[model samples]
Target: MSQLFSPLTLRGIQFNNRIVVSPMCQYASVDGFASDWHLVHLGSRAVGGAGLIIAEAAAISPEGRITPHDLGLWSDEHIPGLKRITNFLKANGSVPGIQLAHAGRKASHNRPWEGGKAIFPNEAEGWQTVAPSALSFAEGGPVPTALDDEGLHKIRYDFREAAERALEAGFRVVEIHAAHGYLLHQFLSPISNQRTDQYGGSFENRVRFLREIIDDVRAIWPTDFPLFVRISATDWTEGGWTPNDSVALSALLKEQGVDLIDCSSGGNVPHATIPVGPGYQVPFAEQIKREAGIPTGAVGLITSAEQAEEIIASGQADLVLLARESLRDPYFPLHAAHTLGDDRPWPVQYERAKPRG
Candidate 1:
């Protein structure tokens, strides 16, 4: 059997194939609730035969949301809608996962469709954003408040509570979104984090926040379920977070019971020159897996069955996550299986549309 279609067992959860639906934000929620849009968006990917479907980054608190419309897990009221989606995903043979996120200084921004500008806390649909350091993501943008000890402690508690809520929502995998210049990544990157405290400066100090979050989440997350950490392997700029940093961090995460690293890049620095191309981020996964001795997921510009198959076949990455391509073709996994001559079952309702054997 093709490795791309092979089963991968992480912790006690068995994935039917290596293809995962990478979390893509659809600014379609209200008050942090998962609406029917989320149900259909995630459910269709499951129906399309992905082994795993990671829901879009769900904020741990209202202030953590990237935009007002981003999904959230901070309230018990959010559970039923998520539970409904998980039920559908599991019934369709896909493991449902969620990327728990805090956007830090990037929070309180207009949605992409709405110009993507920073919104003032006093303005409509906006609130004060917080981060490791009081800095603006770009010139003339709003400056975020540097997190105090009490705020930091609250964020940690929020993560643990979010993990508990995810479990109650029946999610099988819980991925911490430490990548893409978000709250945790802010602490990790020297370019963003400028604190003199225990959570910044030296590598060990910078990684303290993420390490503590892993400890908090794992304390509540079940042992049998997998825990994934999504990280931007590089900032693509000098004096920024690098692939080496990712490898080092992955090593510590592995020791803390993190099952996999979802490797992507270039969200930390707005001006970083990333060589965007096909499978551009795959090398990060390869290096981290080889150097850190941890399983990794390769994402970014991976759009073809052949390309994805080669990645897994070459042992470059243990999993291939598709975002834009999956959006374009929700059934990409089923189509990929057929393209690679790996027989994956199509849903009974769609079997007639399946291509010739």
Candidate 2:
């Protein structure tokens, strides 16, 4: 049997396969409400046979959005729209998940199609950005306000509340977005976090914020469901967050009841040189899984069935998350089953087109 199609259980959730539809930002929401666009976008992947479908980063607070159009879970009003999508995914045989994130200094940006530039607080649809430090993401870019004790308390509260909303929305898995140079990643990387308090300075202090957020969310998030953290793993710059730090962090997260570490790299710095290629980030997953003794999800350029199969078969990672590849072919898993000679069932409506044996 193809290992990629093999069932794996995490906590109380059983994923029918290792194929996961990684959260890809749609930038299609209006006032953080999921529209029909989101419904079709996510629902199609469920129909395409992904075992798990994680919706894009939903801001824990309005200001946590990466763009004005980013999805959100900051209010009860956001629940019903998301519930509709989750219901469809569940009916179609996919475990629904959502990534709760705070964009931090990365917030208030124009959509990617609109040049991806920063929209200053003074600009329309933009609000003040906040972070661990008052540093700007880029030179001459917007300098975010340094978060104070009150601000930190709010962040934890927002995450806790958002987790409750996610539960109400019918999501079974929750991934805390501590990655991609965002708020939590900013706190983790010394390059971005230059504070002198308990939430910064030493490695232990640097991880304090994220640890607190996890505790806050996990407190309310049910024990039956799995909770995951997506970490950048490596900042890809000297003196930044390293794989060693990731290993140590993963170990701590495992102790904190985190089920998996979604390992990706090089998003904390703007100019860091990343050796981008197929499975380039898999080693981080392998290292963390081995050294930290935790399950890890391998993401980044894992585009093919064979490559994904090898990652799981070789004990490199427990799950493969596809973003762009899944975008190109929503049915990649169904097609992959054929490539690996595994008879994965297709959606009955589409079975008429299934390749004859």
Candidate 3:
């Protein structure tokens, strides 16, 4: 059997294959509630035969949102809507997962369709953004308030509560969004985090906040359920978060019971010159897995069944996460099974459409 189609067991959960639906924001929600769009968007991927479908970054609090439309878990009311989607995903034979996120200084932005610009606090649909330091993501961007001690405590509490809600909503896998220049990434990158306190300076200090959050979430999250952390393995700039940092952090997260490291890179700075290409980020996943001795998920520009299969077969990463490619082909996994000559089963209703030899 192809490694790509082989089942992966993490904690007490077993994935039917190595293909995962990477979390991509739809920017289609109202008051942080999952709408029918989320149900169809996620459910279709489940139906596509992905072993795992991680829903887009769900804000831990209202202020943590990248946009007003970002899905949220800050309230009990959001549970039912998400639970509905989880049910569909489970029924469709995919493991439902969620990425809990706080966008930090990146918050209060207009959606991509609206030019993806920052919306200042005084503007409609905007609220004050917070971060490890009082800095703007880009020059002339809105300066976020540096999180105070009270703010830190509250944010930690929010993550814990959000994890609890994720369980209540029937999600079996929970990934902490520490990547792509979000709140936790803000603390991890010295370019973004310049604090003089215990939360900054040294590597240990920079990682403390994320460690605390892992502790907070794991305290409530079931032991049998897999917990993943998505991280920017490199900032792609000098003196910024590097692959070494990711390896070390992955080791620590492994010790903390994190089941996987979803390796992604960049997004911590505006001036970064990432060498983007097919499988450009796969090396990072390979390095981290080898050095940190933890399962890693390779993501970014991975669009082909052969490429994904090679990743798993070569031991570069334990899983392959698809983003834009999955968008273009919701049935990518099903089609990939055919491309790889693996007789992966199709949904009963769609079996007639399945190509035969």
RMSD values, in order shown = 0.7, 0.6, 0.6
lDDT of 3: 0.96
lDDT of 2 by residue, 127-233 (tens): 99999999999888899999999999999999999999999999999999999999999999999999999988999999999999999999999999999999999
Candidate 3: tens digits of C-alpha lDDT, residues 1-357: 889999999999999999999999999999999998999999999999999999999999999999999999999999999999999999999999999999999999999999999999999989999999999999999999999999999999999999999999999999999999999999999999999999999999999999999999998999999999999999999999999999999999999999999999999898899999999999999999999999999999999999999999999999999999999999999999999999988999999999998
Clash list (residue pairs), candidate 1: none
CA lDDT of 178 in candidate 3?
97
Q: What lDDT does the true structure give each of the candidates?
A: 0.95, 0.96, 0.96
Candidate 2 Cα RMSD after full superposition onto the native fold (Å): 0.6
Q: Write the per-residue lDDT of candidate 1 for residues 121-179, one digit (tens) a residue.
A: 88998899999999899898889999999999999999999999999999999999999
Global lDDT of model 2: 0.96
lDDT preference between candidates 1 and 2, better one:
2
